[model samples]
Target: MESVRTCVGCRARAPRAALVRVVAIDSQVVLDERGSMPGRGAWVHRTHECVDAAIRRRAFGRALRVSGSLDTQTLQNHFQRNG
Candidate 1:
């Protein structure tokens, strides 16, 4: 069976395949397209609304258990290109 995860932005439960996995590396948020990154993972929908909410609520740091601001430019770029 497919795993379920919560979207940090909307706080809604969704199947793993319905959401995208994000991970932190070197204090930067990176998109895990393959969902095989080695680190704490946070899941969120690919919509700009969800991404915006996640950033607005500062959910990444909390979800990833990090203690400082994280760079989300890469995340934004992904959305921009794919959005």
Candidate 2:
């Protein structure tokens, strides 16, 4: 069985291995491409829609429990990178 994680954007629980891990560093959202980051982590579906939702709703901030800015540039970069 796969581990399960909840998306801060869609708030849907899914297999951990099926989700993407995101971490917050200095109040900026960082994609944990390896899922081994050493800080609080948030999970989101590995889809553009999910990633956009998290950014649109500021769910990353809520999930990471930090109050600060989000680097949309990096998020867009990730989306573009995945394309």
Candidate 3:
């Protein structure tokens, strides 16, 4: 069976491997490609909209329980870097 995780933004459950694992680091969000980061985790779909929504809604901060906003450009940069 596929492992499942809940998206902190929409609170939707999906296959864990289908989600991108985001972690808060030094108040910035980093995409955990290996899914082995040791910190609070937030999950979002790999789609552009989902990622944009998550950043716009500060879903990572909500999931990581942080108190600041993360720039959406970072997520875009990540996708460019990873894609």
Q: What is the TM-score of each candidate against the true structure?
A: 0.96, 0.87, 0.81
Shift in Å, residue 28, candidate 3: 0.9
Better by TM-score, candidate 3 or 2: 2
Kindly report which residue pairs in candidate 1 clash with one another. none
Model 3 segments beyond 4 Å from truth?
Answer: 80-83
Worst 10 residues of 1 by lDDT: 73-82
Tens-digit lDDT string for candidate 1 (1-83): 98899999999999999999999999999999999999999999999889989999999999999999999988988898899
lDDT by residue (26-80, candidate 2, tens digit) is 7678889899999889998888888888889988878888888667578668777
* Backbone atom clashes (below 3 Å) for every candidate: 0, 0, 0
Best by lDDT: 1
lDDT of each: 0.95, 0.83, 0.78
| Full ranking by TM-score | 1, 2, 3
Which run of 10 residues does model 3 get worst, by summed lDDT? 67-76
Off by over 4 Å in 2: none
Better of 1 and 3 by TM-score: 1
Off by over 4 Å in 1: none
